[model samples]
Target: MKNRSNQQKKSDRSTSQGTSNIALMALSAVPLLMVLGNSMLIPEFPKIKSALDINQFQVGLLITLFSTAAGLSIPILGFLSDKYGRKIIIVPSVLVYGLGGIISGLGATLLDDSYLIILIGRVVQGIGAAGTAPIVMAMVGDLYKSNDRSEAMGVIEAANGIGKVISPVLGSAVALISWRALFFSYAILAIPISLGVFFLTQEPTHQGQKEKLSSYLKKILQIFREKGPSLLISLFAGMAVLFILFGVLSHVSDILEKEYNLKGLTKGLIIAIPILFMSSFSYLTGRYLKQKGKFFKIAIITGLTIVGSALFFLPFLKKPYIYVGILTIMGLGSGFVLTSVNTLVTSSTTSEQRAG
Candidate 1:
């Protein structure tokens, strides 16, 4: 009888472990999908600009509007996720994201002057994006503890880096079918991912009374009070690296096309080199930082210094390969910076206060 009981307990533990691994994969998809929403459209910018008969600055608004809407909506969506549950916010938001994509694709294909319609659809997509990757960060915190939390956050960042690595190539390839096809792909992709998040991942059950808004606010404030400077620095570092990364990618795409006369897959392959370095480094960084809480500050500083040095030399280089080499160095720095920042922020507070 005792042997049977022990066997049963072992079986349960194995089952639980398997479920957790599946859940982690679904969660990782959240960031990757969110990245595809924007990054996948980047390589098509010139084609889009020409199609819509818009200037560079005007065409740029598509990305700008999406980001702006997402930024503005994130806090509201975060609060809702805190109240309702991460999956609830994520599932519907993903559907909305898909819907927005369909709308944009239709407008681009069917309308004569569809620029405004496309912009509107991007705004909708942005709102959906707001509830995705950011909530996944908090969701991971809710689901894991201690060293697992660090490792999971690292995987999340790595997924994000991987998305960056693939998006340019994916975008270029899809645009071959038709640039409008790119917008429609979002809907197709979101359905399975949302279903996975809804079904495969389980949200941790919160026991006891839900905190009132006042109490929640106070707890959040206290966390900031204790870790305000470090938190702020981490936030800034994360944002700065992404800004540098996307800005470099946009510029590089244009340079490849106009200067080198490279287009489509060749251009995309070149663009992906740096991002591949970033993703590879991000995974390695995450593994190294596991349970080593003391090294967060040092990692951030080292990563930023590497990025700064690379950026300094970038303008002086006239050769495409060398320029790409410098960006690869930058990507390496970004991988370290982002993984460290993600782990630090997620681990800084309890799940209850994470969204706040």
Candidate 2:
């Protein structure tokens, strides 16, 4: 009788853990979807500018505003999630993100000042998104054993690649009908996505060890004092340089059209070549990291590729095939760097600190 009861208890524990992991996976998907919506907007920039009667710079500002808001809010929301619980932050954040999309859609349809309204909506969306990506990653840190955590992180990273893959094509198609419809379509997805997260994912229980704000601040300060400076420096330097490279790449479709006289889908295909290379390399790097445990080496290779590609672009900017080759090298480099960074960040932090 005792043996049977012990077996039953073990089985119950295993079942509970399985359910928790499934929830974590679902929660992870939300951020991937959010990123998809964000990336998809990139290709639709021209259409949006045309529809709203805005200039290229103004359209660029929209992208800037969204990223800036999200980046600034991440630590704040991360702190809140640590204090309260994951679900408390996540559920509300998802709804707010969806609301932003809806508001942006409505503004695009109803208002003459659509660009202004869209900007406001993106800010709101960023606020919510700030919580989604990091928190989901933090939750994966919370739920899994240390050895399994990398695989979980890899899965999330893969989902992100999948989002990037589908977003441009899907976003472009919707924008074709009406750019406003793109926002509305994303908003609709958000509603169902949020509901899924709420119902499926459990809020991890806080272990009754709440710290005072002063202590929390002190600890956070200490974390930075010890580790923050280097990580911040690396993150900022890497992200800034890469952002400029991506900005140049973003104009490739236009370059092809203006300089090479390619049009329509052909122009898009030329632009997509880099993303395709990026996605393929991302998948391969994630798999290799899982198997080889050589993240630092891979990252170095990626960095060298980026520098080489940039140098090559200086000389061969006019040749279409050469541009593609250089960009592909850049894409491969980016994939390795991103995968390694994410793995390192997740691996280096403890659960409590990761929640921050």
TM-score of each: 0.83, 0.81
Clash count per candidate: 0, 0
Q: Which one wins on lDDT?
A: 1
For residues 96-136, what per-residue lDDT tens digits would candidate 2 score against the true structure? 88888888989999998788899998898888888787777
Model 2 — TM-score against the truth? 0.81
lDDT per residue as tens, model 1, 142-164? 89988789888878887887887
Error of 2 at 238 (Å): 3.1
Give stretches of model 2 more than 4 Å off.
1-25, 146-150, 227-229, 256-272, 279-308, 311-316, 319-323, 343-352
Check candidate 1 and list the clashing pairs.
Answer: none
lDDT of each: 0.86, 0.71
Using TM-score, give the best candidate's number: 1
